[model samples]
Target: MGLHQGPDPYDRQLCQGSLQRPGEDIHPPRPRGSGDRLRHPRRERGSVTLAVVRVRGIINVKNDIRDTLTMLGLGRVNHCVLIDETPQYMGMVRKVRDYVTYGPIDAETAALLLKERGRLEGRKPLDESIIKEMGEFKSFDDMGKAIAEGQLNWS
Candidate 1:
């Protein structure tokens, strides 16, 4: 006794590399006009406008940062492109310029400044209570005479 099933027709067709699918273009193609290719046609006899800002950086090697800027719609290095200047775009460019031009602070200078700050904060003298408990004595002579001449006693 055996229980067996034959191969599915769809699977057989796929295995034989004869699988077919429907065409993406279902409608009949229409003839394109002169302006049909453009999504936004350019205006005729109007003023052309552009905004340009200087970008400075060492962009020769390690261009991941540059690539990221381009991905966000900024043009290539050393070349200018017309872009829509919105507040958001302005902010993005400002940040990129800051990063490229002004690099990180040096570690030595940072450490020196930190050490100087600690010294300045920690060099305060002893408080007034300790000074007063020393009996307003300004010199070792005052302390010694008071003890030896019996003017002051500690018994």
Candidate 2:
């Protein structure tokens, strides 16, 4: 048996399709930015997120209640928005609780909702760049989670 058990990098370069081009060095370049780009940060298990879905019309709603709903991005009927359980948001929710329904949201459910309903004005799709420009986070799931935890206040 030889001292080296495995094939050398040069030997496998051809088989592995070497990415280096003419004049390029054999050493690969270091990755840019934080390595956490691919893998998201772990959250505590059983952490509950808050979600609100407008269940009634805004017609004839009291001025205070209507204003609260509008501020919450719930101007349209059946418009569902994810929020944290902070006292400020909770108070707003309380003001219009009669016209909406809310409950705890799990991480999986939040991801699904963000994929489907998350977006910017003018029907523009929400992506990593937009998320970064709007908030500190770069990942869509992170944005949703931060908002749910009241760490990133959209309102």
* Top candidate (TM-score): 2
Report the lDDT of model 2 for residue 62: 85
Model 2 deviation from the true structure expressed as Cα RMSD, one decimal place? 19.2
Candidate 2 lDDT over residue span 58-93, tens digit each: 778789898899899898988888766656777898
Tell me how far the alpha carbon of residue 57 in candidate 1 is from the true structure, in angstroms, after superposition.
4.8
Distance from true position, residue 132, model 1, in Å? 96
Question: Which segments of candidate 1 are over 4 A away from where they belong?
Answer: 1-50, 57-68, 72-75, 98-155
| Runs with alpha carbons beyond 4 Å of true place in candidate 2 | 1-48, 127-155
- The number of the candidate with the highest lDDT is 2
